[model samples]
Target chain A: YREFYQCDVDVIGSKSQVNELELVQIVDKVFGLLDVNVLVKINNRKVLTGFAEICGFPDKVVDITVAIDKLDKIGLESVEEEMREKGLTDGAIAVIEQILKLSGSTSEKLASMRSLMNGGSASGLVSETGLKGLDELEELFGLIDAAGVKCPVEIDLSLARGLNYYTGAIFEVKAVDFQIGSICGGGRYDNLTGIFGLPDMSGVGISFGADRIYDVLKGLDKFPKSLASSTTLLFACMGAEELRYVLPVAAALRSEGVSVEVYPEPSKLKKQFDYAEKKSIPFLSINGGNEAEAGTIQLKNLTTGEQKSFSKADISGMKAFMNM
Target chain B: YREFYQCDVDVIGSKSQVNELELVQIVDKVFGLLDVNVLVKINNRKVLTGFAEICGFPDKVVDITVAIDKLDKIGLESVEEEMREKGLTDGAIAVIEQILKLSGSTSEKLASMRSLMNGGSASGLVSETGLKGLDELEELFGLIDAAGVKCPVEIDLSLARGLNYYTGAIFEVKAVDFQIGSICGGGRYDNLTGIFGLPDMSGVGISFGADRIYDVLKGLDKFPKSLASSTTLLFACMGAEELRYVLPVAAALRSEGVSVEVYPEPSKLKKQFDYAEKKSIPFLSINGGNEAEAGTIQLKNLTTGEQKSFSKADISGMKAFMNM
Candidate 1:
């Protein structure tokens, strides 16, 4: 079997659209932390249901959404052709094209869709389900704005998420500047637990491709430099005597949450320093015979080339200095 | 397919006994963090080989060790019976029993076995390979003692690890007080990568069963109470107006590394507090109309029944207070 790994977050219970809004906030927070600019395309399935009804072929909702889902790949004309081949009339195809192509902010676009679904179009269409979808979108977008979600969000009418089995808000996230497919997506399911025997439990969830996110970070060079080193400091091994002296100090620093690596064997100071440098360790502690006799530690900031001395027993002070 | 998960750690490119020492230290550190008392059993395959030679059946090493490996479940008389059935002379079986049953400290046991294997017994046998194994074990144990591994370390003679494919420094870890299977085990392999075409590389490694460790932790009630709560603080949602008031404050606290959850919908004060209590959220932030007007937050520590007020914009101070 083909295998890969993806992180999934699922929230169970509650019919409140606030879960949807919170999911959008999660997308916003995640991308914000990763320094990735994103655009969240959101739509509701009820709106698509109303769209199918208004277009005079409610039974063909799956066909229409599946075709529309390919708009980015096959273009509008080909999507229309696909819909035409799926038994939709020219008039219905035109209505699909017009509504999905409506250009505005998420709120403005929902308003336009609401007007069209309310018989503003020449087809004299009116759909309560579609209007409800519009209302949900309006309220969700309001919550997102009030929460100050950082990413740009849009109402993409054609983003039916490929006939996804969602009953409420649908979400798809893409990196704004990266040339890749959707990095994250999820939607609301009216009966997420029905297959396992419980019914009518509404829930929303999202999953992001970890590999794509890693690629985006790598391609854009956004990974932190600190990640290159696992050890925050390296204590140079002078000999058995020095190792004994620094053993407790290293343990103290470790307990204080600093990752300290003590060189296992005595080696040339130059060799030890090179080992620390190659590993990108930020600090180096040297305890030779002199330091051992003097009962002090000679610490050097590898990055800044700053040197300082500390009492051998001042574990907390040494830790604080390294943190600084 | 049956499936499970275990974390594996492998260290490559070192032939020094220190690698074995480090692996033991890792076991010590992991169990130390888990608060489990464990005994680390260490042995070497070469030593087993030498024992077979000293037992007068150099060609029957696998059979002798295999029979001895079952000593725990099958008892000594049955093991000797099985060995005799496999063409081991009764004298050899007696020798195997004598050496494996040496009752002493690890060092004392090794010393007794060293004298016996050096032509002290009636078999008048000596094994260079077995001597090297003992030497390697001596160095590794010395390093472990010097490095001050916290867990008890022992040398086990009958620990053949079931015909395991290891070359040196075998290890198995068991909880001292828990009646469960071994939680961790591993050993050194002389040519780990030779199967994939890279040859002659030496490595020491260990794998601990995550499920078994979890079971031990759970059965012993060692899991931390802090693992129960994810949200550090829950803001009581009084209404849309109050939610808006706490939105930025929650964001600020979240940016300061505090987990902040804003109740999604307005509800009665008791209901909101019940939600916080159910989720184990320690801190509850209430910013009702009065607090909103006063530009302050009414924060209560649910666990301690302590209340404090902070200026709405002082996120750091609020974070520090929550941390305290």
Candidate 2:
């Protein structure tokens, strides 16, 4: 309801970390194609829950994640203050802070988080769930490395933005230069279909932020030039008889799969050319009394200002010229 | 709300008969492409009004045309009964019958109607509007003939189907063998925008009866086969490693504008093949452990049972085989 259009590319039925890598690669490829720089930040619900448990606040995972999600906006002090208000002691808060501040490459962050979780919390709580999520992250990053994803991927300990339904990897994509909020985001749901009376189906999905992507493409002026019009060639209407002479020829080129349009009226040459230019038609075929009488057409390349002659019957030749 | 969608192809600012001919030709081409046989029936409002005037019921043109429009379903006696109830004399009814029964080609029918209108009604009323509509119809058919429209075009004297705003040519297309009613219809409105306070701007438009055409296509089994999907090829997932082996290959083929899908699951070969068949994916790339290690792909043309081998790096060769 918050976004304009949400299309989930759901990779259902596989719990393999390969699916997680595929999602990362898709995020990379889509932004790469759009010429937008993006960072794919990933975290796991199990890992976040593990952090909460080792902090001796296992049942308060949601509260901890909600507060820390604001760490970037309100700063670490405010985040820790919110955690303390949720009934966390200073020792528990310090341990959680140490895990959140673990920064390095994906592998290095996973290693440090593993050692810190293994070191046990102030209340001596150990988290196997945290270790499991770290393993999944390591495998996902391994596959991502093998696939050579071009976009940057990050391990964000503070990301718990996906709805509480997600049981595994959580993905949040942000435009590096665009000021718009997350341009795309989704996560893994281990039992998404269980609420529908279907049990235990694991899926990973991502939704592209269609509205933000459009704004990004528009703001950046990255839309391909060819989408202006599919009209490959235009036949200028010089005279009624000339228009009559070229109709069949234009239809011929169209039948051969060349997009062709004939000026609807016998307007002035300047007007016809302007119309073609406005519609972004690349080539124009011009004919006058002499050419019509001789059964010939003068084809002009609007882009290059090159002119060539073709017999009125030569559809393939005209199409080849248009292609060239 | 009556039809699922009604898209009117409006040709504005052009009162030329060429535009009418183009509409007719487009109807012909669209129906031809859909593999549905259609009869393009044309009538002019002026000609209908002229008939009413010459019948001494110029003030009752709407009543007269409305009654006669039902003549095909209600029969001549019933239609004449309704006309008489609306205050037409026997003489006027006889003259109307004489004109309605005039059967011939478009040109011949136009000529006879012209003669009959010139002969005078019971009140000795003559209609130049009738002559003008007849003349326009003649020019329109002339263009249609010159363009060699493939579908049957008929001047239906009883046809007054389009709403009363039409000032010139009226069109209705019906499936030749289908039991349903008109599949497409429209007319020329000389002052369509006048009601909206934009006067004297004439336009010709036809709305394709999308719902009916879809039903017609379904009834006659006339829809094109390719519309079922845009996917050109599917890479079968035999195993995790094989799927990984083909992901980049699938991405490469996709970059070349080929619609390729790598089966998202490493299921049984039979299951993957069945999935391909169900999705109407034409060609499929298959690989097992041996093929994955050798960096080779076995491409299968599912429709033809032809299979070919290509190395993983030989994307162009694999694409060519798919094309073949």
On residues B222-248, what C-alpha lDDT tens digit does candidate 1 reach at each position?
998888898999988888777778877
Q: Report lDDT (CA) for all predictions.
A: 0.83, 0.82
Compared with the true structure, what per-residue lDDT tens digits does model 2 show for residues B1-324?
A: 363887678888767666787788789888887888999999999999888888877888888888888878999899899989999889789878877678877788888888877754444668889889998888778667655678999988767765477899889999998989888888899998888888888899899988888889989888777788778898877765676677777767766778877676677778888888888999988888989878888888999999999988898998888773
Q: Per-residue lDDT for B121 in model 1?
A: 56
Candidate 2 CA-lDDT value: 0.82
Candidate 1: RMSD to truth:
5.3
**Candidate topping DockQ:** 1
Q: What TM-score does prediction 2 earn?
A: 0.83
Q: lDDT (0-100) at residue B250 of candidate 2?
A: 74
Model 2 chain B, poorest ten-residue lDDT window? B116-125
